[model samples]
Target: MRIVVADDSFLLREGLQLLLAEAGHDVVASVADGPAFVAAMREHRPDVGIVDVRMPPSHTDEGLRAAVDVRREWPAARLMVLSQYVEVSYAEELLAAGEGGVGYLLKDRVSDLDDFLAGLSAVAQGGTALDPLVVRQLMARRPDPLAGLTPREREVLALMAEGRSNTAIAAAMVVTPGAVEKHTQRIFAKLGLLAGDDAAHRRVLAVVRYLRAAGG
Candidate 1:
C-alpha cells in the first residue's frame, strides 16, 4: 500500500517510514507537517495516510483536521491518526468515519510492529481500528446507558461502538451475523437509541454513553 507519513518529529516520521517500508509497503511521502501532508496526498493520492495528531501551524489537531478534510474530498482514502496520548475527540471523529478505512492509535502502539502494520492493513481494506488505550479511555468517560446489559450484550455493543457491521461483529463473535444484529437491536433498545441512525450519530453517542459509565 502506498502511504504518506506526517509527523513534526523527525525521529517518529523516519521511524514510521522505515517501519512501513520494512513491512513491504510504499512510503510515498514523508512530511514534517500537516499542510505538507495534505499537499502530498493531493499529489500522490496514497492508499493510506499515517498522520500524527499534533503537527505544525498550531501544533494541535492539525493532522486530525487534515484527515477530516482528506476524507471529505477523497472518502475512499484510508487514514490513521497517531496520537501522543488518549485523545478522545480525535479518536471519536476518526473512528466515526463509518467503518471504512479509519484508525486511531497511540504512538506507543508503534512498538508493536506487527500489530501496527495489521492496523494499517485493516484501514487500507476499509475497516476500523481503535487503539486499546483509546477504547479504554473512551469506555471510561461515557455514562453507561447499557449498564443493565448482560456481559455478552456489552461485548456486542463495544464492537458496535467500534463501528463493526453486524456481519463483522458476528464473525468476530463466531456467531451468525443475524445473532449479532439481534444483540445490536437489543442493545439499542436498552440504551434507548433509535435504530437507523447514521454511523456518525450512533458512534459519537455511543462514545458519550460509554465514557459516562465504564470508567474502566
Candidate 2:
C-alpha cells in the first residue's frame, strides 16, 4: 500500500518511513508540518496517511485539523492519527466524521509493530481502529452514563468503541459471534441508538453515544 507520514519530530518521521518501507509498503511522502502534510495528501493521494496529532508551529492539534480537512475533501481518504496523550476530545472529533477509514492510536502503542500495521491496514481497508487505552480512558471518565449497562454489555460496548468487528469482539470475549451480536443489540437498545440496516452507520452512532456519555 502507498502511504504518507506527517510529524514534526524528524526522528519519528524518519523512523516511520523506515519501518513502513521495510514492511513492504511504499512511503510516498514524509512531511513535517500540517500544511505540508495536506499538500502531500493532495499530491500523493496515498492509500493511507499516518500523522501525529501535534505538529510544527503551535504543536497543538495542527496535524489533526489537517487530517479532518483532508477527510472532508476526500471522504475516502484513510488516516491514522497518533498522539502521545490520550485525548478523548480529539478522538471524538476524528470519529465524528463517521464510520470506516479512520484510526486514533496513542504513540506508545506503535511499539507493537504488528498491531500498528494491523490498524493501518484496517483503516486503509475502510474500517475503524481505535486504541484500547483511549477506550479505557473514556470509560473511566463517566461512570454514571453507563450505569444502566450490565458488566457483559459494558465489555461488549468497550470493544465496539475500540472499533472491533463482531467476529473480532467475539474472539476477544471468548464467545460466539451470535452471542456477540446479541450483546451488541442490547448495547444499542440501552444506549437508545436506532436500529438500522447499515450496521456500520449504527456502529458509529453507538461509538458517538459512548464518547458523549464519557464526557468527551
**Candidate 2 lDDT, 32-142, residue by residue in tens:** 999998999999999999999898799888898889888878777889999988666666566667456888899988999998998898789777778988877766776
In model 1, the runs with Cα more than 4 Å from the true position are 145-150, 159-216
Scored against the true structure, residue 43 in model 2 reaches a CA lDDT of: 95
- Put down candidate 1 lDDT per residue, 154-207, tens digits, no spaces: 888677655466787888899998887777667667777777786445544554
- Give the Cα lDDT of each candidate: 0.75, 0.84
Clashes of 1: 11
Clash count for each candidate, listed in order shown: 11, 0
**Highest lDDT among the candidates is held by which one?**
2
Top model by TM-score, which number?
Answer: 2
Q: Weakest 10 consecutive residues, lDDT, candidate 1?
A: 207-216
